[model samples]
Target: MNRTFNAASTADDVLDGIDLRGRRILLTGASSGIGIETARALAAHGAHVVGTARDLSNAQAVTAAVLSDAANGGSFELVELDLSSLESVRRCADRIADSGPLFDVVIANAGVMATPAGRTREGFETQFGTNHLGHFVLVNRLASRIADGGRLVVVASASHRSAPFSLDDLNFERTPYEPQLAYARSKTANILFAVEFDRRHRARGVRAAAVHPGTIRTGLGRHMGQEVMEAAIEKLSAALVAEGQAPFQWKSVAQGAATTLWAGLIAAPDEVGGRYCENCHVSEVNDGPLGPFAEGVRSYALDPETARLLWRRSEEMVGETF
Candidate 1:
């Protein structure tokens, strides 16, 4: 992959001329935004995509739309997935794993951002539970069901640079809960999960990667009020201007899903397993504090030891073994 795509590339742009006939893909948060475009493009390329949404009716609507317009392409099915609940996660995984064929790729794309302090039904921090732990358990339960030479792509965020992860207090149990840091920590966990998953499963011919979709004005930001969103954008824009980087702007949903598409379908993509990617390329690794609008991955997010530790804690938290 010579990095032919950028932050502005759409899902269809990345999938141009690529064939995916007979492939089976499992994609989370598939009803809207990046998820919908990813599903549309991949299905357009002849991949049978099993897309999950918290609500099945909404997913069905999206599926209907995808199918009605596709003159020639693979198809889509809907699954009910609620990432905030382990019971829901288990049910969704079991349904998918038992009801049909093995998945060729799994894209964990649904997530919440900048949410207020709250706990999941299982008593874990909401963001960590949904963004990392929920996906962790879901993927682990389905790990063996992925076809040989399969790929898994976890959609993380550049906001991961906002804070460092604290293993000792992943749930904000002691430290006061900060919404931004909680979201950042969850995004970092997404990366670490990918790192460890690739390390553990590469021998099985399964590769895992994490992606940072560029800033996009998706429903993921509905949690943030207008004032909060404006202030954060201003802050990041100021930092980017200071760093001499291009000014920040919202990318299209298709553009946002392009890196995820790249992660799952790039040529010889296994070579980049365990890497944090943005703009359809393996981002440079930077040490020390990362500015708000920094471009590369923080070395801390890719730390091998931390990845392993996160894996152990994740299994314990999920109370399951792969």
Candidate 2:
């Protein structure tokens, strides 16, 4: 029942003919790249957009960019949000909640990729803290105000397939922490969050989905050293050449934003809830070993039991319940 789209498709293409006039949408990390592109496309189709960034200046720049685009006929507003801190999450959610009208869509697209081992304000590992825990608390705080038919989209990564869940060392407190492993754990948590959220909230008509925005160049790579990046690029190029394919197979930012747009607006509601998506499609679960990015979701990421357990654990960690 899963459908497929490709890297060549744009956000506008996925959103074709979809009228969103008057619908209120909130996008995190909207200051640049895919989040900004998605906001522009949504606004162009007439949705009222509230975009959040860590810096007021960056948020304003994004807002100005959206307003300057002729296709974006609807209005755009900016808000301050620092995902690394739970207090910031609370304040940001409180501010949005106080602003009145409910949001029809919430896109948790802000994220940090592989970074050096560290912890958040709450003492959780940085990747898990910012990418998954922040969004978890944000959604729970805003649950009351999310419209009946609203959608919550968590922008995950195919990298989640790189590692299975590690319940014992989720924080890397005892185990030697590898940055990619930490990131993969966080991404797994993203899928688990969506699956459990949908399980709990879908009965009320609100749905949640996790998306893998195809490998695209973005600020998420800011943490990597230049040598690491060059090495990665070289490996990718060699792999492409070995397969007789073009080097730099990643999509443009606009192209990368298509799956998020599709999951947010186009895919059949019943067809997608609780599933993992990439390249604008619900990925088919592969039975055997995977090749690099082609690895299917791990059992831990998809297990309902694990999802529920993680949900409870996350609530305990954040000291907040929905």
Candidate 3:
């Protein structure tokens, strides 16, 4: 049966009773918000977690917080990873690869949203470069080291529903770039990346899935102006108060991490690979416009041909074949 959870369900709730002793997990963006909460849940479940962030100091702080509250026998290690740079991704992966333990789950959770237009070190648009391409390269580089039945969970968004893949101007070279469009494009690429990854690796006992964590109150909104934030709040307030919908379409950090935990640790890889998931289950595919908290996958985001093209382009840009 298809299961559905809500914004109030925390990572612990999804992970309750799961025994993960000896499992090793790699989590990105572990310094704050959903990433931190997810790390806490995994560590509490007895996984040997290696959590990464841009700053070693911040990563250490997150590690300390998790370890302080960890159940007996839980552990976490910190690693440095800057997703915006291919060199950084390679170095981080190389370090973990040399660590001698096969990763059982990889959560690609760090991301920026609606930030001012910029370019990564490799000259790709910042959002597409960091949110999708960075993780794409990281996963491919570490693919062989992932355990045979491991899971790769890409933290995508409902924003992908806002726009389909724009192949012609993906790098924003020929068009005026909009932050939302760029974010949507990167998220679309995330789904496509997973589709192709699963196609190539599933037969080898590796599986990939993408997830929408739902809107949550986090530093992810720091880039927006007050008016933009207020407008979003107002819309959400109206949805709950006036329309009798789920009140205030935002999840707490712990709640926001639930679907990711489920996808990473609970869902059967063969049953869920290459699909977009939310609320701890495969979301019902929708064709209409997305509601405040519900969204559907677009055809372009799941197109096999586009996935292959993006994979090839990623390799060309990163100068590494996978």
Q: By lDDT, who's the top model here?
A: 1
For model 2, state the Cα shift of residue 11 in Å: 0.9
List the candidates' TM-scores in order.
0.94, 0.94, 0.95
**Native RMSD of candidate 3 (Å):** 1.9
Pick by lDDT: 1 or 2, better one: 1
Q: Enumerate clash totals for all models, in the order shown.
A: 0, 0, 0
What ranges in model 2 sit over 4 Å off? 1-4, 70-73
* lDDT string, candidate 3, 1-322, tens digits: 5454665778888877877888989999988779888888888888888888999986786567788757747788888899999899999989988885899998999999888989999999999999988998888888988899899999999889887676777789989989999999989889889889999999978899999998888888788877889898897778767766656656788889999998888888876799888877886667677766655677777789999998898788778788
Can you write out model 2's per-residue Cα lDDT over 1-322, one digit (the tens) per residue?
4445676888878877778887899999988779889888888888888988999885786557676652545778888898999999999999999995999889999989888989999899999999999999988899888899888899998888877786777888889989889999999999999999999999888888889888888878878876888799889889877887777676788898999999888888786788888878787776468765563666677789999999989998999887
Query: For residues 1-322, what per-residue lDDT tens digits would candidate 1 score against the true structure?
Result: 3558777788888888888888899999989878888888888888988998998876787666667644356888888999999999999999888888899999999899889999888999999999999999999999988998999999999877777776989988889998888999999999999999999999988999999988888888888888888998988888788878877788888788899998899746555698999988889888666666558888888999999999989888888876
lDDT of 2: 0.85
Q: Report RMSD for candidate 2.
A: 2.1
Question: For model 1, how many clashes?
Answer: 0
Runs of candidate 1 with Cα error greater than 4 angstroms are: 1-3, 238-246, 289-291
Model 3 lDDT-worst window of ten: 1-10
lDDT of each: 0.87, 0.85, 0.85
Query: Comparing 1 and 3 by lDDT, which wins?
Result: 1
